[model samples]
Target: MDRLKALAFTTSLLALVYFFTQTKFTLSSIQWPTSLFGGKQQPDFSMYKSLSTLSVQEFPLDPAQSRRTVIIGDIHGMNNSLSSLLDVLDYHPGSDVLIHVGDIIAKGPHEGSMTVLSYMASHNITGIRGNHDQKVIEWRGWLDWLHRFPDGRKWLTALERRWDEAAAGGADPGVWASKQMKRHRSPWWRTIPKDWKIFTEHYKIARAMSDAEYRYLLSLPLVLHIPHAHTFVVHAGLLSSDPRYKPRDPRQPLARVPTVFGSAKSKHGSDVPKLRRAQELALLSDIEQNTDPWVKLNMRGVLKNHDVTRGKDGRPWSDIWNRDMSRCGGFEHDLSFDDAHTTPNKHKMLPCHPSTVVYGHAASRGLDIKRWTVGLDAGCVYGRKLSGLVLGRHKHNDLKKHQSPTPTDIPFGDNFTGHVVDTECQLE
Candidate 1:
């Protein structure tokens, strides 16, 4: 009986040692209270996975404070352009607030993304998620999901090599993935290498991202509101149809709208052939009128090729945005929170002050500056100037004296007060 007892103790000690070695946790480093029985606690990734699509952030500057607030559009890995633009603006890091519209990476110099992320972190900048940024999150999320299994890192590295090799020969990774998915339809996830080829060139950048940088990217909200500046910043554009449209799942990125809008790839997702030309025109009219986003339920009403009406240079989503959400009863109707201090949720239907919107992601039109809506993406990756919008602070007494204008009374045309700042692109 004593011999058996000794053997059981020895086995338990060996198992504990193996666990410690596997997890890299030791008795000296472990927190006594939380590490009950000396076990390593796994991080809870639920919050990150379920992050909100819309986040309301306030930067209420004291009326007495004097500072500049600037919003920059799609960097697209243009570090030199960003640096030059800041120089042109005479950016004062300590006294200024910087906000970045998305697409901070992709389709440009690979080195720029890391530089941009590092700069934003150091400067304490706020940002929204661009489509490219969403692509990064999806890719990163997929890789992370794979890492839960054994030999995942090895598989990911090997898969990266495969993607690089395919791209070297002028092959489209997404097409390749589509073919693979089609061929193995029963269990798609198993066949997929957990690598998305659309962002093949960005894999290294994605992999090299530090934990904090990854968190920063993942934490980016889809929409930003600055009441003081009367500005709302978004990656692409907001929907006027559902002024109060909250996503069915806040966990999903807010910029994703299922329609024939956006890049060419997104154009092919739905069946638009069924709708007649007149029907298509009516849907466009409905969209313009800020009616329901979907004319019919189950995504069948709108014509898929309706975007062609906007011509080669697509119609700006802002052009169709008929109302200023901040002023209209709309902002109040849409927000989920009940109070000014509380964040919105699904259950809450609260009123919010409307604000002007400044957005990027539409580069074909380039530097579209309307009275209420501004598109700052000047296609920096395509050798266009990177743009910034500068809003100077209003003095305390001036702010008090400033009367808020009614929605219809808001000034338009040349009288719009914001300034557009730009810097020449430096492409290699």
Candidate 2:
């Protein structure tokens, strides 16, 4: 009897504690917070895979390609800084061929910033599509996602259904997003930005591309080959010998798309075509499947093919590998967390242009200098500022002193995870 009484008392005490704990700790809703996406939930490889990989005409040379050209790094939407960098470079209308690596949109100042990119695109800046560029593309594929998730889709459809029923109609994304910010606590929920309309607008661009222009952008080679200069240019990274196999750009018009985009016989696996085209990317169901990204354009929607050689420490791919030439022999690393050397699963053409390959997809924040790697992306998206290499003759040297352009404020990665402020620091 004594034991039974004691057990009952303890049970009551424990129950009381449990009830209090539940009252104090349990949340009434499972909403995600907006801060989580500030920089955490980047786009997956599948995002990049969705964008139509583009290829274009033989780079005419800098008098066509330039005496040299200015190859800038990735700009995750840091628009203000991007403008400053352009100013410092003394960038004129046709003096140089600008190779923008990628990540031009999505993060940072994606707002009025469209005007900048649109201007460049209209002028034929040769902007290579980055992974961020693809995330929006992937989002397009899932346009009806709001009506897809179990709870989310149901809630959305409920509202829309109700409106549709009365012919009142459509939920405003801004209002919905504001509510999400206020109510969501899920980590994934926070990844959205306050100005998500930028996504819709960008989609409109891709969706509305003139049949010719759309095909042209889609036809852009994953790598830009400047043969006269012996230079190769890509948004992220490249291998030595590019694959001769070419797919017609699935974009509109489709007449101009080329079969083979660039120089052949690369050392690395950068020549793989899977990650370079939009049609190929759509083939994938998820991002984690593409672990080894030979080149990643955006964190989201990136579809990559692991460079088998990338797993090897020294002298990665033999195709793009030049026993004599140096730069980009191994996989890229991730320093944000464990500093583990995680290689991407995508690839691009190699021996771009020719000898002096200009690139902007690879960031140098983690690895100081990757082996045999000549990365031009200076991580301008993370508030670190932007950088661009000038393939031009220097005033000091008549024999072509490679002119290094001053970093510009292209505003590529400013709001990488929707963490932008009203304004950011100027690079100049």
Candidate 3:
């Protein structure tokens, strides 16, 4: 019996040695054994809400009453560039509303992110969460989780000290993380791929973040709906309709269309009612509830199968969005094979209102402006221009040349126009 016990102990020690020496392990590769429970696990979103709304009441759209709504694109911690851009715009505090389209931090100078976060917090600036922002949030959450345990607190303190040393020595965080992963031999690190090593910077930023900065990131939603501007601001593009719905013939008219403007007479010639506010909000909410949160943060295109993908191989979501927005009603007749094949619908397409989406995250395309959609990510981190879409009653004649004219089909009625403005950024 004593011999048997000794043999089992020897086998366990050998297994541990094999795992530590032969395997490429890291702390991040740990996974919960949910598969053993025999059911798929749903993502926990209790910590954050997916959607938020902003109205003209909070941010007045009138130029006489307020300056303008300056919606900036993927900042990527270019604080200096951001200041310069604001200077060029002649931004007025308490008068003008500033909104970031996300990717606010990461991929730039470390101090720049903290500076940007401090500035945003002080100024009450609000925006949607980007993919990079999400990564930082996850890291911060992990750090918070670790802080609850005695050993974890020690482990984190050591990790932070090591990071500080790496920074002081001018070592790249990605290189440092790679070395640390190998040295630590934690099973979690083995699951990470080489390309994802860039996330090491994200981890560093997360750990360095102040409580205020972390809360600011946590407060941001995946989508921000502005009722008065008839615009939806999101980190990435939004689908025109539910992907599950079948495609309708663009040529067909709706069975029942909502009235956009009321005919009530006002002091000014006629009273143009709110722009289908209810329908637009419902549409926004529907998309938010149905689509995966990750899709809102990373999607660039939609596949023919109606699945949203981060890859550029699929059809540009903006194109489909513009096509769908141009039409106000649903199809009356059954869709033909040609119609179905040409459109991005696996199920029936419903009526759509002429709503606009102001988004970032697609820096590769850079400064996409359409009648119904505006993509403001101009790759500022890559030394390209940092873009902003200014929407208000005030018109900048200089920016007119850059602005896409509102489509004749849509009735915006001169309440506001979206003008694209940008400034050059320095290479990080």
The candidate maximizing lDDT is 3
**Any runs in candidate 3 off by more than 4 Å, and if so which?**
1-46, 162-199, 249-275, 285-290, 329-350, 397-415
- The TM-score measured for candidate 3 stands at 0.72
Over 4 Å off, model 1: 1-64, 161-195, 242-315, 322-354, 393-416
lDDT of 1 by residue, 122-234 (tens): 65577777767766766666566556644445555665576677778987867865664566453313523334463465656667777777778777866665433445566
lDDT of 2 by residue, 1-428 (tens): 99999999999999999998897676434333323424444333133222222232333322233443456666665667767666655666555556676666655554523544565557777756665565544444333333333555555444444434433345554565456546644444433343354224455444334444443344344455443333445555443332221211222111111123455322236543322232123212122322233343322111234322222233332223332133221212111121223434212211111133345544533212232334556556556657665444323222212333322222111110100111123532
Q: Deviation in angstroms for 50 in model 3?
A: 1.4
lDDT of 3: 0.69
| Steric collisions counted per model | 6, 95, 8
When sorted by TM-score, best at the front, the candidate numbers are 3, 1, 2
Taking every candidate in turn, the Cα RMSD to the unseen true structure, in Å, is 16.4, 17.5, 9.1
**Each candidate: what lDDT?**
0.54, 0.41, 0.69
Q: Which one wins by TM-score: 1 or 3?
A: 3
- The whole-model C-alpha lDDT of candidate 2 against the native structure comes to 0.41
Q: Provide TM-scores for the models.
A: 0.57, 0.43, 0.72
TM-score between model 1 and native: 0.57
Off by over 4 Å in 2: 1-68, 141-219, 240-356, 364-373, 396-428
